[model samples]
Target: MNIPYAIPECRVAHLVERHHDHLVVPVRLDAATGCCPECGHASRSVHSRYHRQPADLPLSTSQTKLRIEVRRFYCLNPTCRRRIFAKTPTDLLAPHARRTRRLGEAQARVGLACGGAGGARLLAHLHMPASRATVLRLVTRMPMPDTPAPIRVGIDDWAIRKGSRYGTIVVDLDRHRVVDLLPDRTAPTVAGWLERHSSVALVAWDRSTEYARGASLGAPQAQQVADRWHLLTNMRQAVERWLHGAHARLRSLPLLPGSTVRPARRNRAFARSTTELEAAAQSRMRWQVVYDEVRHRHAAGKPLLAIARALGLARATVRKYASAETFPARLPHGAGPSLLDPHVAYLAGRIDEGSENAMALWREIREQGYPGTSRQVHRFVAERRTRPVRSGRKPRSAKASASEPPGSETLLPPARQLAWLLVQPTSVLNESEAAVVSRVEQDDTARAVTGLARRFTALVRAAGKGNPVADDRDAAADIEAWITKARTCEAPAIATFASGLEADIAAVRAALMEPWSSGQAEGQVNRLKLIKRQCYGRAGLNLLKRRMVLAA
Candidate 1:
């Protein structure tokens, strides 16, 4: 039978033997001499003969194994350190290996694409059986391809263990491939990496000071460019923060002609139980006391450790309280969606139709496949019924009531929602969003904030599109002018944000001029996260680094 595989200097001697699901092919070496690996001496005299069986790729529906008849030749050179050497096809298989070179490569690729256990399950179905451990071993033994030197690179931090540990991912911006992964996001770690890649002429990063310092220390000749996306993101956050403090104004803004407005309660106690209000007030007061004490202690030159100890609080908590420019509001508790959520629209329709009975509403929903109890429907009806009732008021005529739509109530957008509308381009805003924007713009402070946010967004988009600039100096001047306006603006949050930009002026300016950004680096981080999840936490940093650098 002819040999299906290309085994150098070898020939198929015996016919294929089929045993259950296995197919074995006996192979014989045809080489006349063997070379000594120790001294490079060739010998033709044979000392012994033996068989070495190694697994190969599957054949049809059966696992194939090559039973290679190998010869052990005596070294002709007495000066050689080795007494004997094996005559085998080195190109086909590695010494002391149980699989051919081609087979090992296939398994390594499988291991990389599908992690350990996943690869093993896949290989078993393909008739090339291997354990998870074996698959990982193949992946580790596989050599890494050499990467070309990079001219432009972007660095970003990725969460290894979110909210706690983080690592750095370095991507070659020009080639659009990951170059290396660091164990930590520290400046020293990043600097050491950059120092090794001296070919890098430009380094793109975020507004992080650690990355900025690292690039400066490692590659001073390389110009650092801040990511444009991150700049806009930070601006959006500043707008949101400012809106949080000025949210009361948003409530008083005039509603659109057809917009819904929330009805006010005559009795404030009806909004929430008196007990709930008192509890919330007491909680807020406690937070205010702690917040004030922490700020005062910090202002008086007290260390975070001392403050935490004195307050019986964690260092992180104390530090958070001290770092805030404004007091952090306690987040309201929001309940998760219930089994009754899908039936809310149906329930509302019944309620508006004058069906006030909770059991009746529950029965109607149950017919529609709602699995929740009547108590859930009862709570919903009770909340809606708690609005203050008018005593002895004249009822509206049927014609007057029919003029307005049913359930139409005035609803004011929240501060967070308003902040988003302000920063977004007008072209993307819908009719309702545009109406909200128009109303907010009526106030001088809101209009100014909106103008500055829109202008900043436009600048970043223009820079990102790589439009031809009239002059680098002109673009810088525009940015500088915007910064000046933002710094002296009435909004303190935005002013502080603008001051931070002025502090990182060099990198920010480079961001406007250079086309390179960390966008591709962020994409690589996403891919890394996928691979990390595949490992199921069994793989360590070294293995993860190998898979990321090698896998597609």
Candidate 2:
């Protein structure tokens, strides 16, 4: 029979013995002399021949094994480590390995694609059975790939533990591949990596002080482009901050079409119609008082730490209250419509009919297709009991019954939501959203802030259009004019944000002119997050770095 497998510089005498689902082929080495792997000395004197069995790729439907007659050679150089060495073919097989180079490589690739246990199952189906541990070992043992030096790199930070630990990922924007994953996001680490890669001509990153300082220290000649996405994000956050002070106005707007708008509460009073809302409103009023006091103390030249200790509040809380331009309301949790919404009318009717037993009320609502728990019903009845209305009188529904004046109920769109509606393109807004935005813009302060925000958005987006206007002094002049206008705006947040831009004016200008962005690095960080979650607690940074860098 023809040899099932071939080996160069060796003679294969195939004696195909198909016994019990195994294919065995015998082969012999053709070379007269074998070199000692350690000493590199060629010795023709053979000690003794031995039968060696090593697994190979499956042949047809059966597992294949190579039974080779190999000779051990004595190391001629006495200076070298004294011993007999096997005539191992470095190209065909690794020393002491039970599989061929090709087979091991295939298994490693499988391990890379499907981690550990998954890879083992896949390998078994492919007729190349291996344990999950073996597959993982193969993956870990694989060498790191050598990529060409990067020219323009994008860098961004990824959370290892959100809000606590973070690491930086660098991507080659031109090649669109991850260059390296730093262990930590710090100035020294970033600078050290960039210093080694002198070929880097540009570094694109978010407006992080560490990265900016690092790039300046390591690659002073390279142009640093602040990411445009981060710029727009900062601008949106500023708008949101400004809107926080105008939250009452937002609540007053007749935005929701079918819903009733509640009469606006004046002077932070706890005069809400419902007991639950009244409690919530009272809580807000209490916090608002604290906020006012904190600001008063700060204005009196008291330190934040001292004020925090005096008021029994955290320093961070005191600082936030002190710096806020207006009282920031903590919107009630579960602000969305409740499960009891559809059955509110039925519950209220049963209550009016003298069915005060919470259990009886819950059963009635449940039979009427209410999915909410009995606890919700109990809470609803408890609130009604606290109200001073006549016992026989009909209770108002949670939404305020139709007997109340039209527009007596309102839902406040979050400041973040309002900021997005203002900054985003008008063409994308739905009819209702467009109408609300139109009303919002009618306010003088909202109109001014919105105009500046839209202009900044356009200027940043224009960079993607390859507009020469962004590259010229015209963009600079326009941005300067916008900043000047923003500084004079009634919104303190917008003015503060403008001051920030003025401080980092150089990078802001580069963001408008340069097309390169940290977007690629952000994409890689997303991929890294996927890989991290897959292996989650099972792998360490070494394995994660290997998988991210080498797998790509």
Q: Model 1: runs farther than 4 Å from truth?
A: 38-41, 78-83, 248-355, 364-373, 383-412, 438-444
The residue-by-residue lDDT of candidate 1 on 339-416, one tens digit each, is 877787777777787775678889988998988678777656655542322453232233233433332233335556
lDDT (Cα, tens digit) per residue for candidate 2, span 329-426? 66533234578767767777777877777788899888988987898787677555424345655443433434233433344456778899889888
Best by lDDT: 1
**What TM-score would every model get versus the actual structure?**
0.82, 0.78
lDDT of each: 0.81, 0.79
**Which prediction has the highest TM-score against the true structure?**
1
Model 1 scores worst on lDDT over the 10 consecutive residues at 262-271
